[model samples]
Target chain A: MNKKTPKSYENMLEVKNLKTYFLTDAGIVKAVDGISFSLRQGETLGIVGESGCGKSVTNLSIMRLIPSPPGKIVDGQIIFEGTDILALPENELRNIRGNKISMVFQDPMTSLNPFLRISTQMIETIRIHQDISKKEALAKSIEMLKLVGIPAAEERIFNYPHQFSGGMRQRVMIAMALSCEAKILIADEPTTALDVTIQAQILELIQKLSKKLNTSVILITHDLGVVAGMCENVCVMYAGKIVEKAKTDDLYKQPAHPYTFGLIQSVPRLDKAKDGKLFSIEGQPPNVIDLPPCCPFHPRCHKVMDICRNQYPPTVDLGNSHEVSCWLYAEHKELADA
Target chain B: MTKYIIRRLLGIIPTLLIIITLSFFIVRVAPGGPFDTEKKLPEVVMRNIEAKYHLDEPLVVQYGRYMFDVLRGDLGPSFRYKDHDVNFYIFQSLPNSMILGVIAISISIIFGISSGMLAAVKQNTWVDYLSMALAVVGISVPLFVIAPVLQYVFAMQLGWLPTSGWFTNGDGWQTILLPAVTLAFADFATIARLTRSSMLDTLRSDYIRTAKAKGMRSSSIIFKHAMKGSMLPIVSYLGPAFAGIITGSVVVEQVFRIPGLGKFFVQSSFNRDYTLIVGVVIVYSVILVIMNFIVDVVYSLLDPRITYK
Candidate 1:
C-alpha cells in the first residue's frame, strides 16, 4: 500500500478534454462532454455511473471506435505513449487496438462468432496482429485458453461458441483479449451479463492476471461493488461528465458528490440491516438532447440551490487526490469541517 | 435432424400433387385440343388419338390415366411434332437451358456477393451508392430490354464477337454468350440487391463489432465475418431463381434465336401439344422441389440454431 505513493509514474495514456457527440436526426447528443484524465503504467481505474453516463463512451472515444455520421469524437486529444491516437491512420490504430489496447465487450455470447470454432476465432485473432506460423498460433491460442482457466484447452478449442456455457464464453472473450499480452485492457461491463458466482470468478481472474502482467485496466461498469473491489482510482460520471474522482478508499469513505453519495447508499449492505428498503435515486437521467442549461442533475439533486439551477459547478478539490463537482462542496475550508 | 428432414420431404408430397393435378386439368380446359389446327380429323382417327391418351373418356378417367403415365415416367409422343416423345425432346433441350442458367446464376452470385460485401464494409461511400444504383437499374430494366441494347452495343456495333446461336456449327461458347447474358440480367440485379441489403444488416450485428474489436484486418472482417454470416438470405433466394433460369424464359430464347427449353415450352403451348406441355410442367416441378430441398440443407449448415425437426 505504501509503495503506491511517490511511485515513479511512467505515463501510459493522457486524455485531455475529450468530447464525443452523436449527430442524430432528433438533435446532437453530447454523449461525452469535455473530460480530462491520465493513466500511468500498471494502474487500474474504475469508471462507475448509471447507463447513459458516458463511461463506455469515454473508452470508445479513446479507441476511436465510435461509428461516424451518427457518432464522432469532435474534440479530444488522446496522447497514448507520446502519440496522439486520434490522429493516427486507421491501419496503425488497428494494430494498436488489439496489440496495445484490447477490449472485451458486455455480451460474451454474441461477441464471439457463432459460425466459427473457439480455436479458429482465438487463433485468427492471434495471427492478425502478429506474424507466427499456424502451429505456433495454435499453440499460443491453447495456452491462452488455459491461461484464462479453461481446462483441457486442446480439446475445448475446437468446440463452437454455442457448445460453451455463458460463463465459458466470457472466458473465451477474455482469452482472446489477453492473447497478445496487451498493455492496456478496456473491459466494458465484462461481468454484467453473467451470474453472480461467475462474475466473482471472472473479476478475480482479471485482478490476478493484471497483477501478474503489471497491465493497466479501465474497468467500465455500473456495479459499485465491483469497482470498489477491483479499482484503485475511481471516477463517477453523470450525464457525460466526470462528476467526481478519488482514490477508491477515499471515494468510499468520503463521497463528495450527491450522485456518488446516492450510489454508495444504494448498494445493499448486509451490515446495515436496512431491511427491505432499497435506496432509489429519484427521477431518471436527463435527456442528452436538450439538457438543461445548468447542472444536468439539478432537478433530481437534493442540494439544489438558486445557483445550482442556473450555473454548472466547477470541480472543487478535497485533498488526498479527491475532487468533486457539486455546489455543496463550494466552500473549500467549510467542506472540511462537514 | 432426420425427423426434420423427413417432415420437409413429406411436406413436398401435397405440394407436388396439387401442382400436377391443377396443371393437367387447366391445360385441358384451355380453348383448343392438340389437333385443332388440322382439318378436323376423321371421327375414327380422332377417337383413337383421344383413347390413346384416355381423353376420349370422362375428365376423371383422363386425369387418372395421365397421372398413371406420369408415375411411369412416360410423357407420351408429341401430337404436332409426331413420333417425337415429349420426354426425349425435353431432355434434349434442357441441357442448353441448364448451361445458360448455370453460367448466369454463377456470375450473379459471385459478383453480387462480392460487391455487396464491399458496399457494406464501405458504407455511405461512393462504392456503396454506386453498387446500389447499379442494382436498381438492373432490377427496373427487363432483360428483354437490356438484351437487345447490350447486343446492339457489343455485337452489332462493337463487332467484337458473334451475335447469337448456341454455337457457330455448335462448337463452344461463341454462340451461348448473348443468350446467357440476356437471361442472367434480371437475376444478377436481384442477387446484387439482396446480397447488399443482407450484408448491410449483418455488418450491424454485434459479432461484426466484436471482430473489429478483435483487431482483425478490414478485409478479413468483411469476407470471413460479414459474408459468411449473411449467406442464409442469399441462399434462400437462390433455389427458386435457379429453377426459373433452368426452366428458361421464352422471351429470351425468341430474342436470341436459341432453341432452348423455353422455346419448346412456348411452342408446345401454342400448338396445344397437351402431352408435351404436361411433360414440361412435370419436369419444371421436379426441379423446383429438388432445389428447395438443397436450400434447406444449406440453411441448416450455415446456422446451427435452425432445426427442421
Candidate 2:
C-alpha cells in the first residue's frame, strides 16, 4: 500500500501521544497515557515494561482492537504510511489491518481456532488481502508453512491446531500473520509462553523473517535480554508512560532514567555470579487509575527529589537520540535534597 | 464416526428391553384391569373373557407371551379399542405427530438460534432485552395456556385458521399450524436462552479475538468462527426434546383434538389398556436412543477434539 508514497519514506509508523483509557465502575484507568514513538522502515523497536504498563495497549490501540465501552482511545494519532489510521474510516482501517499491518498474540494454545484446520486458517488469511484463487491460496499457505520451518508442511497444513504442539502453533500463527506480506508485524510477547530453548529459536526465526521481508517489527516484552539481542531502538515504559528511549547500546551502556537503571540492575546475569543478593526495585508499580501528576517512580527511586513529588519531570535529550524523564536529569530544578 | 454409531445402535437393545419390561409390569400394577367395568358381568362370562386373552394364566406366563409377540413385531390387540391392534393405532397416529413435531422443531430452531445470536451480539440493547423477554414469556406460560391463547387469537379472532382436529375438514396444513406453533413456542424459548449464554461465552474466547485481529468481517467471525462452538449446548438439548415432540404432546394434541401418540398414551393409561401403553413407551424409548446417538455424531463433527475410537 506504501507503493503510492515515495520510495524514500523514512518512518514506516509513528505514534503520537496515544492515550488509551478503560472507564470502569471504580475509575477511568489510564492504560496508555500520552505516549509517543516511531519505527523506521526496516528497524525493530522494543517496548519493555512490567505487566500493566500499557505495553500491549499501546500496540492494540494502533490496531484498534481494544474492546470499547471499557476501553477508549481518548486521544492519539497512529500514523502509518503518512496517513493517520486512528482517524481513518472502518473500511480504510480494515484495509490496513492484516493487509499492511499484522499482529501476533501471546498464547498459541488458545489463539488459533481449535476446530479449523491449519490449512483453512492460513488460506483465509492469505486470500482475504490478495485476490487469489483457493488453489493459489493453498499453495501459498503451504509455502508459508515451509518457510516457518514446519516439518512436512504438505501434510501438517491439513491438520487441526490441537494436533500441533504449543511452539508449533505459535509458528503457525507467525506464518499466517506474514502470509499477506504485511509491512509491519506487531508481536506482543510472542515467545513469553514458550520454553527457554524454544524462545531463542522463535526469536531467531522472527529476526530472520523480518530481515528477509524488510518488515518493521514492534516487539513488546518484559525481557530486557530479548530487546538487547533483537531491537535496534528500545523504549523503557513505566506506569503507562515511556520513561526513557534510546539506541539499545546507548541505553544499556549509559542508562539515564532512574526507573531504567533500576530495571537494568534487576536483570540477573549468569556471567556475574558473585552477587550477594539479586537487585530488585522495591514497591509495586503505582495504580494507573487516577494517577497523580508527577513522576510515578518517585516513591521507589533512591535519588528521589522534593520537586519530583510535585511536578512531572520533562523529557531531557542526552544526545545521540537518548531521552530520559526524571528529576535527576532536570537542569532547572534546585537541589531540594542535595 | 460410523463405528461409534454402530456401537451406539447395539447399546440401544438392552435399553429398549428395560423400558419395555418396566412399562409392561407397571401397567399391570395399575388399579383396574382391561375388562373391568362399572356393571359386573356373570362369573362364567368373565372367566371366558380372561381365558381368551391368556390373562387367566400366571403374570410371568403373560409377560413371556407378550415378549415373544413383540419380537415378531406384533404389539397385540387393544382391549378398549375393540378391533384395532396397538400397532395399527400407533401406525395411524404416529405420522400425524411426526409431521406436527418436524414443523414445530424447524420453526423453533430457525427463530431460536437467530434471536439468541442477536441478543448476544447486541447485548445491553433493546434487541437483546426484547427477544429474551419473549423467550421468558414462552417458558413461563404452560403449554395448555399458550395453546388456547393461540387457538383463540389465530382461529377465533383472526378466523384465519382452524381451532382443532386434523384432516377432518377441507383444510390441510392450516389445521396443523396452531398446534405446531404451540409446541414450538415453549421449545423455542428454551433453545433461545441456551443459545444466548453459549454464544456469549464463545464470543469471549481467545480464538474469537484472534479472528477479529485477523480483520475478518463481523459476519464471518460470528457465523464461521463462533457459530459451531456455541451450538454444543443446543445440540445436546435437541436430542431429548426431539424424541419427546415426535412421541407426542398430550396437551397440544388434546387441545387441538389431533390424533397423536400422546392422545392414545393418555387414554390407554386411564382405561388400563396395558398393550397400548407399553407400545407407546417402546416408541419413545427407541426415538430417544436414536436422537442421543445423533447428538454424539454432531458433537464430533462440531468439535475436532472429540474423536471416535
Of candidate 2 chain A, the 10-residue stretch with the lowest lDDT total is: A1-10
Please report the candidate that would top lDDT against the real structure: 2
Considering every candidate listed, which one attains the maximal DockQ?
2
List per-model TM-scores for chain B: 0.91, 0.96
lDDT of 2 by residue, B1-309 (tens): 678778888999998888999999988887889889999989999999899889999999999999999989999998788878999999989988998999999999999999999999998899999999999998999999999899899989999998987974445768888999999998899999999999999998988877877778888999989998999999999999999998889899889988888888888888898898999888888899899989999999999999998
Q: Is the docking of candidate 1 incorrect, acceptable, medium or high quality?
A: medium
Model 1 accuracy (lDDT, Cα) = 0.84
lDDT by residue for model 1 (A1-338), tens: 11112233377887788999999999989989988787778899999999999999899788788877699998878878777888889898898887888888888889888888888888888898889988899999999889889989999999889989889999888889989898888999999999998999998888888888878999999999999899999989999889999999999998989889999999988887557787889999998885666888898888787777877787888898799988787885544433
- The residue-by-residue lDDT of candidate 1 on B80-192, one tens digit each, is 78767888899888887888889888877888777777777778899989988888888898877988897898889998756766663474576677777767667777787
In model 2, which residue pairs have backbone atoms overlapping below 3 Å?
none
Docking class of 2: medium
Superposing every Cα of model 2 onto the true structure, what RMSD results? Answer: 3.3
